[model samples]
Target: MSQPVVVVENLVKVYQKNIRAVDNISFYVYPGEIFGLIGPNGAGKTTTLRIIATVLQPTQGRVLVYGYDVAKDAAKVRRIISYLPEDAGAYKYLTGLEFLELVAKLYTKDPKKIEEFIEIGIKLSGLGDRLNDKVKTYSKGMLRRLLVAKTLMVKPKVAILDEPTSGLDVVNAVHVRESIKRFAKDVGGTVILSSHNMLEVEYLCDRVAIIHKGRILVVGKPRELMERFEASNLEEVFVKLVWGA
Candidate 1:
């Protein structure tokens, strides 16, 4: 088996007042794969992603990205990973093109590479002339597309996305999902994303971890889980596991 690009071992996170946002959960994501954390709100999905992204430190256990400990070697992990939060926002004052160019510059000083990155961002976004419009003018769906493009364009070894397609209409949701698939398939990018949308997780992830009440209840391919639970789909399996239906 190929080595995993990301690994989490018995991870735990506790907030103030001893609120355990994430319990002892463990999972691994292989290269060129899209792995998902599926759960309802406050189920600890975002908390786990944040710990992996180095945005938050785990109270116990560890997350390793490409052999670098997220807490001990945070700088190295940051160099290889890009994190997009669920409520991620763009610079509303800047035009979409300007934002991409700005982010590209942050990644590299070479003008050629900057242009190359921006081109990739534009391609991923599928926002043609609208790129010229200021981000403040974009619809909710359009802004999300731009943000997703920004997250993937730099070509990080690992992409951590929280609710990548949340709150978008059907057309826009499909666009975001396709963009995610294209990045993983074409660039061999490794992605770890959290989503409450079962269908989206079913379509996008190579493997999935069903999280509930801060603990991982199951981790498997969608079909495997469906079969194991004797359910028709991931949604039904999730209900059976979490609600014990």
Candidate 2:
């Protein structure tokens, strides 16, 4: 097996010196795998993803991306990772194509490379002619597709996505989920995403960690967890572990 692409070691994040948003927890993500962080709201899922993305520092412990410490090698880490936060908004004034172009420029200065990335973005987004339309006119689902395209277009080594399919109709949600899986497999990249959708997580993830109250209750293949708990599905296992139902 390949070495892990991302590693979190005994991570802890505290706010106001009293609220422990993330308790001491740890996990690893490997290349070409979709690892899901499954939890309810206020479960510290967003905080964990933010720390891995280097947007926030851990109060204790450390995160490493491709063996580079997130805190000490943040710039290097940033270059190799892409992050999509929940409720991420696009530039209302920019056309979808233009928005993609702007992101491409930030990662590279070469005109040819930028064009290549734009092309890739267009294919990934599947927005067709809508690429020329202003982002402000796009529906929520369309916007999410565009954002996913932007995140994966550069083919980063790791993609940290928070609720990548949140707030979408069933059709759009399925499209976005498939896109994430396809992109990671095609590029051999690692993906770590947080999702409250149990079925979505079970379908998309190679492995998952069930988190609650800022701590991980279990981590394993979804099928394995179900079998171990003698539950028929992930949702039931989750309820049993987190709520003792």
* Cα deviation of 114, candidate 1, in Å: 1.3
Those runs of model 1 whose alpha carbons end farther than 4 Å from true positions after fitting are none
TM-score of 2: 0.97
Cα lDDT for residue 202, candidate 2: 91
Q: Model 2, 82-172: lDDT tens per residue?
A: 9999979999999999999999999999999899889889988999999999999999999999999999988889988999999999988
Q: Per-residue lDDT of 1-245 in model 1, one digit per residue for the tens?
A: 79998999999999999999998999999999899999888899999999999999989998999999999999999989888899988999999999999988988899998999899999999999999999999999999999999999989999999999999999999999999999998889999999989999999998999999999999999999999999999999999999961
Residue 175, model 1: Cα distance from true site in angstroms: 0.6
- Model 2 scores worst on lDDT over the 10 consecutive residues at 236-245
| Candidate-wise lDDT, in order | 0.93, 0.93
TM-scores for every predicted model: 0.98, 0.97
The top-ranked prediction according to lDDT is 1
* lDDT at position 88, candidate 1: 89
